[model samples]
Target: MQIADRIEQALDRAVALAQGPGAPPLLASALRYAVFPAGHRIRPQLCLAVAGACGDADPESADAAAAAIELLHCASLVHDDLPCFDDSALRRGKASVHAEYGAPLAVLTGDALIVHAFATLRPVAARDPSRMATLLGIVTEAVGSPGGIVAGQAWECEVAVPLADYQRAKTGALFVAATRAGAAAAGVDAEPWRMLGDKLGEAYQVADDLRDVLCDSDELGKPIGQDAVRLRPNAAAQLGVGGAKARLEDLVRAAVESIPDCPGAADLRMLIKAQTALFFPKQLAREAA
Candidate 1:
């Protein structure tokens, strides 16, 4: 199956599993709304791609990992668009979960998706306990505690912070999980893939920063100028558009070079190149002109 189809299937299965006889109808609908029509699917694609590059011995486990990562990502988005956070009405060009279903249901939906993410790994654990344990550790670390994405969100509520720390925690943590867990899912040492995820995550955030400034809500499928409105730390704000573009290019280069020597290295490099085009389409257009 195509990677996109695999991701959607895994996600669909997860939501199906979440729906029990006693589960509320509204919550189930909200969960579906939050996760469907995915935007980019970058984290899951990164997970699947890294797994393939590492010679995935068990495609099932990798699929679960990819789906779980994406579930967590969707959970983040649902919460991120809440009134307490970005207050975004549109997501993926549709009303955000909260906007469509109200704040209480959105919260429940995000919470349910997060629970379902860990649940998605249970079958994998029965098959390969060690690999499943490692995946869990990697994912929990990315989503929880002192330096995870949750901490990334917490940073926004703080008084003062370094931009790098904030950016890495908010955006890079899950990416680190995606690449590292991909390797771990393949029963390999995950350490080597960390840098690639880190650099790629940073590049993606920079690109998002640029898009927030340069693109309209229609182009982004969400609110524009959010960083400025929210006073969020943004690369474009700190370094200006040209400098942020330069930073994004440098980070993508670093990400590609950081790929370890494997038989699939060429394919992995091409994958990164393709994703870089997604990250900096405007820059590519400018250069072509």
Candidate 2:
């Protein structure tokens, strides 16, 4: 099966399990709403890609890891769009979880997804306890406090924060987890893949910064100029449009170069380049040109 299909199947199965008998009806619906019609699915795709590049000895484990990453990502989005954060009403061209399901349900949905992410890995543990432990540690560190996505979000509340630190925590953490967990899922050394994830994650955040500034709500399916409105640190605002675009290009190149030698390295490089090309907004491309 294709990578995309695999991801969808895993996610669908997860959501189905969550919706089993005795489940709360509205909360279940909210969970589906938060996850379905995925936005990019970049993190999960990267996880599976790195797993494939590493030979994917355990395809089932890789699928679980990918689905877990995506679930956490979806959870983050649900929380990020709440009134306390970006207050975004639209996501992926549809009403956001909080907007469609109300704040209480949205909060529950995000929390449930977070728990479900860990639960998704349970079967892996039964099969290979050691591999499951490694994957759990990777995923946990990416979303937990001190250096994870949670820290990234907490930084927004602090009096002062470094841009790079914030970006790495808020965005890069999961990407790092994705790449590292991918290798672990395949029973390979995961450390070597961290650089690729770091570069790609930062690049993705920079691209997001550019999109927030240059793209309309209709184009991005989310609020625009939020960085300026919220005074959040933004690469585009820190670096000029041209400079941010240049930075993104540099990161993409670095990410591709960072791919370790493996059977699928060449193909992975091509895929990375192709995927990142879509990151540039048409207007940004025109301006850069």
Candidate 3:
């Protein structure tokens, strides 16, 4: 099966298991709204790729991990769009969960997706309990703890926060988890592939920052300039648009260079590098003569 089809099926199964038995009607709807027609299952796809490149090509084995990371990503979006955070009205070209479902359900939706992520891992539970446990732990830490995405958001509220630290948690945490967990699912050490994940995430954030400036609402599927309007410290805000673009290129090259000598690592790295080319040229075209 195509990787996209496989990832979608895995997502379906994961959400199904999460909705088992006593799901609240509103929460179920909220969860569904948050996940379906997902803008880009980017993190999950990267997870599957990293695992396969790291040497576990079964795809099915990596499915649970992919779904797990994507679920958490969905959960994060549900909360991030609340009035308290980005106050976003649209995401992936539709009303955001909170905008459509109400704040209470939005909270429940995020929480449900988080719990569902763990539940989805049951299929791989027996294959590698230690790795599963490690993955679960990593996911939890990446979500909302002192150094997690939640904290990353909270840090923005503080008087001062180190840009690098915020960047790692807010954007890089889930990505790092995606790559590391993929390695764990394949029963391999995650260290060698961690840098690759960081590079992809850094490039993602830089492009995201650029999109916040260069891309239009219709193109981005959401409001543009939310970062500047909200005073969110982004690469562009911190480093001018030109600097941010350069930073993105730097990250893309580093990510590709970080790949280890495994037979599949180079291709995996190139796949990630391709993403930079995808976003950069589009942004350039928008400003061209």
Question: How many clashes (backbone N, Cα, C below 3 Å) per candidate?
Answer: 0, 0, 0
The order by descending TM-score is 2, 1, 3
lDDT of each: 0.89, 0.93, 0.80
Question: Candidate 1, residue 12: CA error in Å?
Answer: 0.8
- What C-alpha RMSD separates each model from the true structure? 1.2, 1.0, 2.0
**Model 2, backbone clash pairs (residues 3+ apart or across chains), number:** 0
Q: Which 10 consecutive positions of candidate 2 have the poorest summed lDDT?
A: 280-289
Pick by TM-score: 1 or 3, better one:
1
Comparing 2 and 3 by TM-score, which wins? 2
Over 1-289, each residue of candidate 1 has an lDDT whose tens digit, in order, gives 8889988899899988888678899997888888887779999899989988989888899999999999998998998999999989999999999999999999899999888999999989789998988999999999987878889889988878678998898999889999998898888899999999899989989989989888888878899998888888999999988788889889989999999877688999998898788887464457745
* Model 2, runs deviating above 4 Å: 287-289
Residue ranges of candidate 1 with Cα displaced over 4 Å = 281-284
Best by lDDT: 2
Pick the winner on lDDT between candidates 2 and 3. Answer: 2
| Tens-digit lDDT track of model 2 for 123-223 | 99889999999999999999989889989989989878789999999999999999999999999999999999999999999999999988898998887
Candidate 2: pairs in clash: none
Model 2 TM:
0.98
